[model samples]
Target: MNFVGYYRLPPVRGVFFSPAQEERLLLLGCQEVFSDRCLAGGVVRSGLDRALTALEPGGVLAVPSLHALAGAMVDLLDVVRRLRALNLDLVVVQPPIDTRSDAGFFEACQILAT
Candidate 1:
């Protein structure tokens, strides 16, 4: 199982996760982690784009949380859309999100929207 991690940091310097979370992801077998630093509420993410492009079909993407994907709901939805289009599965550590199932996918989108 090929797994990848995605995360973001607020442009100003904010830490969203502790070492424990990273350790957990490593235990879950995430070999690569891609992170982006962006201003609050900004949608343009180069790291995200690169991660998406690097991921092959049926790959798994691990995120710490929905909020980490984007500060704005629109950007969050866009990220989800791109992930869906790529046929990549999303595993959000917090809130236990998995986009492999229909309900899970819907719930992930809902969580990001709200």
Candidate 2:
């Protein structure tokens, strides 16, 4: 088989604060399986649980970029931040290094490369 033929597992998403907002995020989200409080309920925890269940193990959770970091952030990096804030374990892709010190960036890249 050609190396190009390979595909990766899917990403999952969740919403808990607002319905319309959540739906919109899902529709516009770069990842698969978006959950909004409108469709899932009013609980953010429930939305998170649902999204987690739908996610494949070791898959990444994607989210919108923060207003502050928008210009310097990537779609995948934003998701990783949200996941970390929510206390989820995910493989953060293309994470930003501006927040890091010079030593930190060097260490992180070394770890990432491995």
Candidate 3:
């Protein structure tokens, strides 16, 4: 299975966090990295859109944290639902979530519920 890394950072604050996030994803075995540096309030997430569109059904999407993936919980839930529908897995670094195994999937669900 292929692994893709995605992250979103505020435009002016990404100088350090962006590279660190990329390196972490690389260490986690992600082959491709897609990033967005834009205002947090902006509705467009071109990088995330591209990553989702490019990843195949069996591929995985890795992100630093839930916050980096979405601006709000509603959006996060929507993305998670889409990922599930697409048969794509997700690996989150912070809070250590993985949807590849039964226990991990359970843990992810618990986290999402809170």
Candidate 4:
């Protein structure tokens, strides 16, 4: 479904996506605009750690792009770490990252160089 409705909505609360995340999510085709992955209507929560697991089940993920690539790495790492902890599958456009393989991490590190 086109995400026109979602992108148009004013952000609700907590850490909503940046414009980039909205674009990525639009490209990924989310059926609904999820504020965050909450459990029991906020009684329990996945936070970033468990939240990213949704990616494997067809959630399009996006990490913030800082002023520069180097700056962005920290943000990217946090995103990756969270996703990795959840064992979520991801598709990175710039530098390919496969947490399962050392080679992928090594290669991605090189590719991510600013």
Full-model lDDT for every candidate: 0.73, 0.35, 0.80, 0.38
User: Which pairs of residues collide in candidate 1?
Assistant: none
Compose the digit string of candidate 1's lDDT tens values, residues 1-114: 358877776666555444655676677678867777776666457767777777889988888887766677787787877777787888887778777754566566868767
**CA displacement after TM-score superposition, residue 68 of candidate 1 (Å):** 1.4
Off by over 4 Å in 2: 1-31, 36-43, 66-114
The number of the candidate with the highest TM-score is: 3
| Rank order (by lDDT, best first) | 3, 1, 4, 2
Error of 3 at 85 (Å): 2.0
Once superposed on the true structure, which residue ranges of model 1 sit more than 4 Å away at CA?
A: 13-24, 40-44, 101-103, 107-114
Quote model 3's TM-score.
Answer: 0.80
Window of ten residues with lowest summed lDDT in model 2: 1-10
| Residue-level error in angstroms, candidate 1, position 78 | 0.3
For residues 1-68, could you state the per-residue lDDT of candidate 2 as single tens digits? 00000011122254223444334435543354443332222223344455655555434443332321
Shift in Å, residue 113, candidate 4: 12
Score every model by TM-score. 0.75, 0.30, 0.80, 0.35
TM-score of 4: 0.35
After superposing all C-alphas onto the true structure, candidate 1 shows an RMSD in angstroms of 3.8
Error of 1 at 102 (Å): 5.1
